[model samples]
Target: MVSDRIRILFNRIAPVYDQLNTWLSLGQHRIWKQMAVKWSGATVGDSCLDVCCGSGDLALLLAEQVGLPGHVTGLDFATAQLAIAAQRAQARYPKPPLTWLEGDALALPFPDNHFDAITMGYGLRNVTDIPGSLKELYRVLKPSAKAAILDFHRPSNAQIRTLQQWYLEAIVVPAAKQFGLTEEYAYIAPSLDRFPTGTEQITLARQAGFATATHYPIAGGTMGVLVVMKG
Candidate 1:
């Protein structure tokens, strides 16, 4: 039910998703996404997966990183978002080595050890089952491969945590109000409250079979990237 709600929310905001992201993050999401891709160790000719690849931002970056002989798959549950991603890819390349699919993150439609690298941007928090999603990610990644998951976090510092809450209520929600997405955007605060902390995420990743896992805090702990390597 949570996944269904999130899917509906994403689909409703698909038209203004890119614009809102740029505004909300002050255009820094691009940099964060790139960081995630780099941490994944994706290289030229290495197949990659970008889960919850909203609007194909990470997937497009992965495509550039793994060019020519390499391939990238962008998977998300929202059809509207995937449609926009496909259109963007078509406009950007004559034949981009990218595939867009409408699929669930908990049950990836891929074989074990299929991808050289994987990246997930702002997706882990919304999954109905975090461990299941991580296990699925581990199952699909090649042995010795890595996955970098980027997401917003509740700052451990009291002051910064208050600031984050204020920003979401005052800035983010109001901005979404302009697009009639106030309700959808308001869920972010509650979701962040329920999301696992970086330390907890590392533990979850290891439990899911990753041999090595590290959570790198970013933006003063307001965000983080969990890098996990499959053994």
Candidate 2:
């Protein structure tokens, strides 16, 4: 499946993933990730999971927010990504003890109703089965737990779509090319096209058995966060 291609592309780009993210987002990605974590409703003592935690940006933030009494797990399918995450976690302090695991998003290894909250950034679009991934997310979170999934959105407005395309080509591709990951980064446009819209994400979340779900658009509609709560 083409999902395998996405996995491979991520592996190829893993080394520069964090840097490129900062560059491409004009350093706004960090704030966006924090917003997702905040929307997850995780607290200082809450156990949390960051699924598809590429290079562990969101995971690291979770670690910081959850404090020492909490546990934070950063799970990704790519060892290259997880390795960087592990390295970063080692130097961080006063944060939750972080665990970096190489695992599939579709079939998480955690027990049922295990985590108090969950956050995922820039990963929902690449999943092979969106609904299946949501189901897995639902299965792992405790009752009344919250989750926030942040990702790119295909802007519906023609002007915004044009601007997105221009930025992708002019900024994202050029920056990625500097790291020799142009091919890897080029998949974004197509991926965004295939990604479900904000409204659709809420529909899928509800169908996956979440008690509450809302889609929040951000950055002039080029991105969104799907906030869901398990009942």
Candidate 3:
């Protein structure tokens, strides 16, 4: 039920998702995504997966890292988002080794030890089952493979947390209001409040059976990347 609501919300915002992201993040999202990809440790000709790949930003980044002969599967629950991702790929690469699929994060549809590397951008917070999702990621990753999961986070610093809340309520929500998405964007604050901290995430990752888990705080704790490896 919760997943359905989130899926519908994403589908509704698919058209303006990228544009709003660019505006909201002041174009820093691209750099953050690149950092996630690099941390993913995806190499040339490697099989990669981007879970909850929303419009394919991380997936496209992974595609570039894993060039020809490498395959990238972008999985998202919203068909509209997947459609946009496919369209974007077609325009950018003549024969980009990319495939977009509509799927769920908690139960990824792939074999064990399948992908060389995996990435998820702004996705971990939205998943209904964080630990389960992490387990699925660990299952699909090859031995010694890494998965980089990136998302918004609640800053541990009090001052930064206040600023983040201010930005969300003041700048983000208002801008989203202009696009008739005030409610959609407003959920971010509460979600962040409910999201696990970097330390908690590391604990969860280990519990999910990852061999090693590291949570790197980014953007002054407003963002983070949880890099987990399979044994």
lDDT of each: 0.94, 0.90, 0.94
Give the 10-residue window scoring lowest on summed lDDT in candidate 1: 87-96
Q: Write the per-residue lDDT of candidate 2 for residues 135-205, one digit (tens) a residue.
A: 99999999999999999987878899899999998888888888888888888887888899999999999
Error of 3 at 27 (Å): 0.3
Clashes of 2: 0
Poorly placed runs, candidate 3 (over 4 Å)? none
Of models 1 and 2, which has the larger lDDT? 1
* Structural similarity to truth (TM-score) of each candidate: 0.98, 0.96, 0.99
What is the alpha-carbon RMSD of candidate 3 to the true structure?
A: 0.7
The lDDT, on a scale of 0 to 1, for candidate 2 is 0.90
Candidate 3 residue 89 C-alpha distance from true site, Å: 0.3
Cα deviation of 218, candidate 2, in Å: 0.6
Q: Rank the candidates by lDDT, best first.
A: 1, 3, 2
- Summarize candidate 1's per-residue lDDT along 1-231 as a digit string, tens digits: 878999999999999999999988999989999899999999999999999998899999999999979999999999999999999999985577999998999999999999999999989998999999999999999999999999998788999999999999999999999999999999999999999999999999999999999999998889999999999
